[model samples]
Target: MGGGLTLDGLNRQPQIGNTRLQAPIGLAPFNSGMFGQDGSIGTDGLSFYRSFCNDRLGLLCVGGLAVAAAGRANRSSMCLDRDERAHGLRLVCETAHAAGVKVAVQIEHAGRQTGPHETGLPSVAATAAPCPVVGGSPSALSLGEISLIVDQFVHTAEIAARAGADLIEVHAAHGYLLSGFLSAATNTRQDRYGGNLERRFRIVHEIVTRAHAAVGHRIGIRINVHEDLPGGMTPDQAIAGLRNLRTKLAYISISGGMYTRARDVIIPRRTLSRALWRDQAATVRTELGVPVMIAGNIDTPELAASLLEHNVSDVVLFGRSLLADPDMLISATTGRQIQPCTDCGQCKYHTKGYPHIYCPFHPTLRPLRSTWKRRRTD
Candidate 1:
């Protein structure tokens, strides 16, 4: 491996914080788009993650927890803005921890990707430019506003820590608020928070530094290796930016793309090559000096194992694969037949206003979907 570490087998356990993963495989955070009105995870949300815990995941990342109301990516984005929300969040942690899996709550801010209709606040970003995908002229964040966001991230980290989470994942990918500031394509301010690459990463550096002081190595980060848009965040730029925060992160999850190219890069299709971001992730692990977790079309256990065998990434994160088959980890461990994800658009482009997520190819999920459909109109 890059750090002189060798993976003897795919079943090796990697330690993060006080939890040791059962295996090197983990569940990348997936937002159900079904949070309560205040962005809290209710009983339904707890059940959603609880079901995945029974499947033998090493780490379960509860995702899309907005740091503030103004940062909500959509109407369904969950929040950690209030202390009361920790009750449900703690329940999620307890459920996963009981299943022998560590939990990390993904703290994020959507930036210009959201609008007043969704957050009941004006869209704000690193710049006033309109996002190509979510059309709107967002107000450029002032220096004071930027400082507030950094504080919000710290506050959220405290709540997640108090709620018994093992780790807090800072979301700085997929064209979100922090991602916007890190990219020259989105951030063009002349102040200290912008201009040079170091300046661009200043916001993330500050947040991670402050959060680390509070929670120590309990902080992990997810970031894009490439943003895909012209003039967007590049691999070299991403690596350099991450160099500023690696010491504080427990691990780094490497992913790519933003809202503009979500279909091809973010959710990806069957036509795209498998292990799409493997090379970039490998590069990061080699150069960034931090344990790396990679996701993006890594569908099979064999493929996931190869990435570890070759010293590409420390952990393999499965998004659509686990959704397609919750028993995937069990099958991978026991050499049972693992179900395949057909890359149907049902779980990708179609679940916008839906209350729940279901994989059409999942044998047992069709009836649940039918039940949701019946209730939607009732």
Candidate 2:
């Protein structure tokens, strides 16, 4: 049913300032630190973003490093050594704010996906089962443990605020702890947190409600509108969940596909279409009465503008696209035809321990310089 509105047509009247962005496009908080081998231990990601964009962009959401930290160490580890985590948060806030971008920290827990050798604690999920990718059987969370996890989300939000983050987004997608609970395929719990869709969504509902109360207007969520898996939460179920959380959330960013299988990671040849999530985003925007952000293989400005023109989403979130070119939004808006990401899967492949992220299309390998020059020249 979607057609018309090319990228050039939308770029004819370019939106420059933050005010111009009806549903502002933004950079995703990718885990550059984890991907890079240096372990520099600061908000290098934020610094990189600021250096590239130069305070022009609004709404910069940091990746869920707090969840990564928690997964790397047990929850008690963070409780025991709050200083390091707090320090990390502080750096992220200062860098992003200094850049004039409203910063939001994504909070997550890997659940059964937790690195076994890293954390040592038994990975926990809504049920006892082996993670499809991580290759470890997780223990089903007890009611007490579930409560603890909820509290952990709240505590993390508090920490994010104290560290000066402008907003907090609960990572309820990508088969993380919250997503694990939300998906019927993953969560087989017989208790209140499982069974029907309502119960299955309780974990997310509780976390969002508590997180909103904990952080107020400064909270949002990145959700998987569809798991794209059999026996999992479908587009319809996800829309219901979004409706339920609308009041509690500041914004709802739509994302899908978990890295549990190779097919889920690669699109077109592997999954349905690269724009599968974009269509789902349109459904979400139609159903939910809140702002919606869409992500997933949206590498072209024309595609993004088409989505925006149709009111598919209030915002477009570019993860690998921005990793390739931080000034992608500016370039597109100003009618500059920049090279789009090829989606070769090299970024994901090299991200495991690569020193820096590079685009196969943009062969220079000088991301910072190229990004800064683009913004500076503009």
Candidate 3:
């Protein structure tokens, strides 16, 4: 993302007040393997990003590794092999720190969205219904199961901390496990985890509270301020939930849409629109008195600066933009107007059916470039 400024322009101006973006531009977990259908390893994902960004970027490692088990096949799976996950995280932390950047990891659970073929466990939600995408009926989770899920989240946080993550972003958005409970549309339970916003938010609150107690100051949450679903939590409801966990949360990251149904619409569209939720984030930041980070299609440095200048958000979380160009943050801060992501969604398309994920737009990954080099030698 370019800021329309030359190196001199950035150097001459007063320093950007918030140092959050000065170095730490978050790398989305990218969900390599574990829960994703593609099943790529976190290490491979980290290696690709580290090489591209030269380790001068913060990363939010995606979490879908089950931390609890109910049976043999239900055991928590690791996204990366034990050594690989730890090594990759250490590499990310060391490399980023050397370049003066910070890193965070996002903790998530697929919940009812987990395919039976994928997780080997029956998909369970607050209420039983047909799966949103595959159209299979699901079972309602028992209260005992709910308690286990909370423990799983806490365990995930602990694992993240051990993985050398600087921050822990609870994935309470995108109609995932936590979001399912929060959304009246998705959650129809008669228990404490359902009903009104307060009750609906109990599971998330407990997760955040336990996460904070476990990880202390390095806890945050990425939430969907508006689910964009019928009967889903609105912006106001999201604000209240965040407010309820004010003391427990360090920062609140704002995002929108339902991941299960609107995956394509959510990532590409939101990733490009810089102004999508600036106002909502500002309002949440104001009311909750916590640092707010806004993610969704935010591509350029100028857009990020504008958001901060207007107090719309405290930080910008670049997802696809970073995928397109890992050095995006460097170029933005250094006043270089590098080529921005075209937002063609080719990266997503490339991974749609492949066993291994690669960015077709990434210059280094171009087969033609390799062929050209070989031809030159010939």
Candidate 4:
């Protein structure tokens, strides 16, 4: 009668790994180099996250920090190793920490997906192959080189840990380096890192286990249960790999598609089935003993809540939806109309050359202003 009311009913506390997220709704890594970095080389990046992170959103998948020079998606992206360039990343972690929001650095290598124009380096992959989108034959990683890349991921996780991140997510999805190794269409090797599920997933398995060994209970994975390529790893194969990695992982987020069929990966067209990976995630939760998260078109709060209620997934993820409205979770909890994502799919295209992720419905992101002279004026 006297105090303020609280929005209830939604399950706010969903535990993933050792970190208990304040809400079941988590912000997927929106885009690398475009949310927080102001003074960095990519000056136009990294503008909205401090406020976005401060919002009711729970998990923050802060991308942009490349594990090593070879992994750099572009020059604008953040690097965890360089102490001088640590400001943007530290700001992200500190901001999330202050808000009691869990943060995970989505450490990834672009692999053959990145072109020389972006990283000033030749594209590399699980094998010396070319993706459907990029040109120039990628240098196949050697055994020693593969070991070195694993070291890079582990070191980056260590950097994230010291930077105050709560978890480390290995980005083995969306046709990245590790994903290539796991896909039959990509990897043609005969070594331990190739062939069947166990061998094909050796790299990711090593990265997750080693990162966990380094960071303890703070390591997880984001992977495609099935790559959309015709000859790629199937859902059955992907599920088998997840089964083995479950013990080593704190949690897993399921995604699909590779670079060739990028639309299938991000689901640009509306005709695709919504919440594409929930079924597989449900299987993971029911059969395997791993906490699973499903991301795709589970846009509305009602649907997200319904999915969680039915035990389809342990966590509900929003990418494009939240990019349109950062406070979608708050609106969902409060029974307000969650802003609908038009799904025009301009955000992904924007990331191709531009340095921002904006909803096609809302194209412009107004930088936060300060009445007092601000540090962002640079």
Candidate 5:
């Protein structure tokens, strides 16, 4: 309404690269702790099965899944490293695909943000820089090591494609290993991997190009369009940076915050407005002329409709809302009032550090969780 965009126009399916999504709604990736400790399939696939069974579910980004053992994030996250792990991923994707849901994984490396308890490997970053929030001095990665990491990204994409993943989201955001190279605060390397925009974004360029070559054009990239730190890249600069690499990527997903600004990205503090990055997403969508996806606190269907009506972005990704009510899209379409997410931040807390994620506001989803766990483990 505000920008010559109408609800009727917005309701139409938009093409992302060569793929056409049924609707603009997407399930954004997080450390959902829905996988096993060995980074394979978890027992919660039944819940996901029910949640994603509807035709209204367009695309789902399954993870900020660990791309390598060295970058293993938490104890119970999924990975694309081994054949056995891919088997679990294949089964999960098969289930989703059977129900008409397309799945993608947000492949990532934790960089210096990894915990010693998580991966048993020393954290590595672009310039031996330590994120202020993470609080550790990381060893600088050598050129050979950086190239190897890029190769691993290509290999991961190949495995993900074979595992029936419809798309691959290269996570270069939120202070991960790739984002470390993108941000000035975390990247101080004097070599080609740091300083200025092009050099710093070299790894991402290589990954997107190589991964797309390996897995076709179903490759996307997620980035922190806004970083509220002194030495971090801001949303405006990030837009320009992305524009430079626009031709390489299939789509661009706009996210914000870094490890230091975790509250804006991971936690989504109440002080911040819902859809906090709406305008930034619009800019990316307009300037770069690509399919743009935005996920922040934009949880409600009304807001999502309004965002599309105004041409804010191409896709609206709901995080905590899906956690609260897997049937949210059905409720929205049926004009039934959907249960809202309390946004207590508890789900994020539980998923990142624990193996189970349930919405306390919707406790009936797992009435006898203890029994469910006993059955799964036994």
Candidate 6:
């Protein structure tokens, strides 16, 4: 059943921020980064999300908003560090509420995956270990810096609450700052924030605790169940760490892989089998007994229905497929011709050279890139 899907919270168990969706399908905040230069939701970003809401999608996770400028994955990403940022977020809330759809703001920090050219400051991470893919010499964060970051996460959550966001999904996957602290391949520290699985999850625990204190039950998280790199986060470790947080969150969104193996992990290719993480999500649902959301090669309604029917995931997140075809949900429900996504890499955004995401097949839906400056790697 697509209706009445619930994501449990501490005080209010079995409720997704007190909102129900028309279906189990939702849009993943595909980091388009076409927001305003000041990291606010500009006209383009609002219109983009509005189009999806009009398509009758259940939930919409707005594009990842950096907690601070230094944590930005790229220059074009929106930010939630200041009070001014709330204005734009309010607009997004108004638009989604008008459409009777719930929206979540995905808050994130890039960590060592970003560089000074993009953030105008040295990238920071759990350790000095360079990102396996981005290959930047990021400075390891000190105790004071880590504390400040924890506060930033809390402050941003407060802003989201004030702006009327139904939930704030903390981005703890895809080799970002929180992901770095959780993975053994990247985090090799002896402090409380690193070492054993529980210790490594200290910062995240602090963030979640403080966020809940500030914003009640509007906090959720997306975490990697299994990183692709050697000595990275294992499924067992993920389950153990999530056990520590299963009660504090509104929901747990399961994802796999760091940026090191982005191809099949983050964005699976067509050749790979669909629902790559189906078993992982099912395991999480059985063990943690908390609501779970999953995404990966879930391109059609039939696949999504099967996952929900089998109790694999509570919500199904669609990424590139929706980017390729915005009216995908409507087309599927109304028995219309649904445009197939070829799994083409053309819509990948925030890459070094390519600054925007646009499907060549749907030229009219392509976001305008007139203001985006080409990123300089030299």
Where is model 5 more than 4 Å wrong at Cα? 1-10, 37-39, 261-263, 350-353, 361-365, 368-378
TM-scores of the models, in the given order? 0.92, 0.81, 0.80, 0.87, 0.91, 0.91
Number of the top-ranking candidate, with lDDT as the measure: 1
Q: Stretches of candidate 6 above 4 Å error?
A: 1-14, 261-264, 362-364, 367-378
Q: What are the lDDT scores of the predictions, listed in order?
A: 0.81, 0.64, 0.62, 0.72, 0.76, 0.78
Ranking by lDDT: 1, 6, 5, 4, 2, 3
Model 5 lDDT tens row, 1-378: 245433343355767776787777888887665666454664555455446556777787787578888787666566677656776677778877877777877788988887565677788988876667666778999999999999888888888888888888998888889988998877888889888888888888889888877788889998887777777877666777777667667789888777663455655774678888898889888888878888888777777878877788888888888778878878876778787887676575433333455566544335535444321221
lDDT of 1: 0.81
Error of 3 at 61 (Å): 4.8
Instruction: Give one digit per residue, the lDDT tens place, for model 4 in 1-378.
Output: 113323332456877788898877677764444533332422333445654565466788886467776677655555566455566677777767787778877888888888687677778898887878866689999999999999999988887788778878888887888888988888889888987778998888788888888988878888777666667766577678877767678778788777663455555355777777778788767877777777887777667777777777777777778778777777765677766777665566334444445454432353412112321222
- Using TM-score as the yardstick, the better of models 3 and 4 is 4
Instruction: For model 2, state the Cα shift of residue 378 in Å.
Output: 38
Off by over 4 Å in 4: 1-9, 35-47, 261-263, 349-352, 360-378
lDDT of 2: 0.64
Which pairs of residues collide in model 1?
A: none
Q: Which residue pairs show backbone clashes in model 4?
A: 34-46, 35-46, 35-47, 36-46
The local distance difference test score of model 3 is 0.62
Report the error of model 6 at residue 154, Å: 0.5
Pairs of residues at least 3 apart in sequence or in different chains that clash in candidate 2: 7-302, 23-314, 29-63
| Clash statistics: count for each candidate | 0, 3, 4, 4, 0, 0
Error of 4 at 200 (Å): 1.0
Instruction: Report the CA-based lDDT of candidate 5 relative to the real structure.
Output: 0.76
